[model samples]
Target: MNNKTRQFFVAALMAASLGTVIAAQAAGAVESLRGRDVETQSREPGKYATEKDGPPIERNYVQQPPLIPHKIDGYSITTNFNKCMDCHSWTRYRETGATKVSLTHFKDRDGKELSNISPRRYFCNQCHVPQTDAKPLVENTFKKAEGLR
Candidate 1:
């Protein structure tokens, strides 16, 4: 072949080889997917933020999780759709000494009243959680009356 044709063939091969190297380099940085076993994946365990890790969103001073100190795993204290409600439900929790769900959970989204635990209350973690080991976003000396000492 003439010089021009030979040069063109060489350039094409060089481009193809360079592309292969780039693709190989990119594969290393890719996230290595773990096995399908749900038990092992981070998502299977579900992540939670502690009060300290969480941005200082103002909580209803009167309403809060009474006993839990860590993000409750998605175990339902009561038999129902996954949420923290299983123990907090009034019907079953009293025996367990778990804090009974608040009375307001009985209200429906439309403001209708129903007896027993409200279906909307099924999501227990929506409001209550345990303390977390994290840094406070900002500093404050505010304390409860007892803490003043």
Candidate 2:
């Protein structure tokens, strides 16, 4: 077809698609669960039971970062201050009985090691998450590693 004819057909097709969507929305045909059980169910309180010296959880897969085993309720981790470093830094771990931050945390994106935790790895929460005893919000079908199984 000619350029003008092809453009006209494309514009008409777009208009038809938009009109169909508008009509469906106006007719209340859009699927929504605004007042359904999933939406209206009473929410449980946010309290979490923390385990400080509990048995270590097995990693689900290889290279899975270990979950935090203790509560970090009042810890501050701003650009200027990382409370986790007080216990987990290399200099303090030996005395504080806390695990040392991984050597990888000291390396930058280029793999050059620094005297301190790399900027990229300074945020402990990015990889380490505290464990909670709360029930799963949804059913999970995850399987553990072969050795764990």
Candidate 3:
């Protein structure tokens, strides 16, 4: 209502508006590791060599989830159906020549064992990726544990 009060409020509002604009511009300048705007949809998958069906790759460390050795393109792994189970299920692995789903996969988060793959462990690709020809985004010098070597 007073001149000084009105002037102070106006100055504060303009400063806040300027701050917001600067922040938005800064955000837009940042690119994600995938080399795209953070908010954008991921780029289309790139062409990578699909590894042929083979024996399981050796683990680099204890307790590492095994890397998938075969191409799994078009595999369906939904809540109701898991294409992987057709070959990797305990009942089918022997005949299919696919590695059986790990025994650990049957344990609940609470450590109780179930008769089938626990829901928490049902999505295989969540932790396991098929080995491909794609290079790492960053360089690393990691090595296998001495025991594994």
Candidate 4:
């Protein structure tokens, strides 16, 4: 084989063993898994929130942690998320007792206060989400800051 090709192969082996790679080489797909990207290159990060019942009577104070009682699998979470604001928006929240969304939702594109859900705050899943099925993966000791306050 050519000396340059042989040199490159030897360099790649050394880099792999070292666990560090340049940006260009790292961006390249791994040779072992060229076509399949099941667990290697899946989209999105962060786990879904958990669903639970209301807090105890003694602890059942104001602004209770919202209960996510419904399943939320494969639900479209795009930039313009209509699936969420349909119910939780200020206009419809009162009709269902679903809690009025933030006042910021009342503003329009020009920042003028409108009487409806603003396009900016329409994506409810960005801050809130309903829980789905269980899949035991890793454990978490992290807690919410609100619980401390």
Candidate 5:
């Protein structure tokens, strides 16, 4: 109730909070995968060491965006210049043999079709990721659609 008593109570509360945090850390309650002991495990293996030189993989589910089959190093996807359009745009697909940008990419959020790739879908990397042979960080037991197999 008095100033001295109130100050003492606040100090005790602060000390108790600090003690709880220190105790949790000592007990390994905040362990992180990246913070594991180096002696117990080596650094995570680098990205898939080799790029596959085969056909694009089949999609496991409906509406799945196809994966990029080739390297996109140095490609730029800036608003002023989308390098992917050089090969994947509708006008260029026929000559370049690159897959055409999907019609869906031309649709606005309200479903009205536009003349070009939608602003929201302009970045190819947002949904379509390049396939890498990287080892899984965790086991994947996902099952494909029945007809896909």
Candidate 6:
């Protein structure tokens, strides 16, 4: 190999070894499966407000699914059971004051109608998400569609 290429590789190896040694000495940190020091890339979770039950947030676009207006931190949704259906199901929403599940949720991928929520749409979190009182992590120029205004 040329002298410059050989020197670059040697320098890179030295830097990597030095980082590993320093990390080990500093915190007894372990190397990840990818050979990175685990402590080198870590951050605490961001704080967010505990959202309260409220009216549904307005959608910014035509096809946007409605956002959950309440916190669902402990709600359970498994293959055999869905806690969301307890209140949002057609039979219960009216009595519970919760919005009814959309009619579209009852259709299969092939557009065939079903008697119950389709398996593909049973997991509400896949499309519906709750909003939090957190500041935007970055600035953006996003605007609602003109028709929505």
Which candidate number would show the highest TM-score if scored against the true structure?
6
List pairs with backbone clashes in candidate 4: 105-118
What lDDT is obtained when candidate 2 is compared to the true structure? 0.77
Sorting all predicted structures by TM-score, with the top scorer first, yields 6, 5, 3, 2, 1, 4
Q: Report the Cα lDDT for residue 70, model 3.
A: 82
Candidate 5 off by > 4 Å? 1-46, 50-53
- In model 3, where do residues sit more than 4 Å from their true spots? 1-47
Query: lDDT tens digits, residues 54-108, model 6?
Result: 8777899889888888877788999998999999999999999888998999999
lDDT of each candidate versus the true structure: 0.55, 0.77, 0.81, 0.55, 0.80, 0.81
Query: What stretches of model 2 exceed 4 Å from their correct place?
Result: 1-48, 52-55, 147-149
How many angstroms is residue 30 displaced in model 5 relative to the true structure, after the best TM-score fit? 17
Q: Each model's TM-score? A: 0.43, 0.62, 0.66, 0.40, 0.67, 0.69
What digit string (tens of lDDT, one per residue) describes model 1 on residues 1-149? 99999999999999999998788778864333332332332333223234322333434344444445434544665554655445556666887566566767778888787785566666555655555433444686755454323
Q: For model 2, what is the error of residue 130's alpha carbon versus the real structure, in angstroms, after optimal superposition?
A: 1.0
- Model 1, position 112: C-alpha lDDT score: 82
In terms of lDDT, the poorest run of 10 residues in model 2 is 33-42
Which portions of model 4 show Cα errors greater than 4 Å?
1-49, 52-70, 108-116, 129-149
When 3 and 5 are scored with TM-score, the better candidate is 5
Predicted structure 4, TM vs. truth: 0.40
Worst 10 residues of 4 by lDDT: 33-42
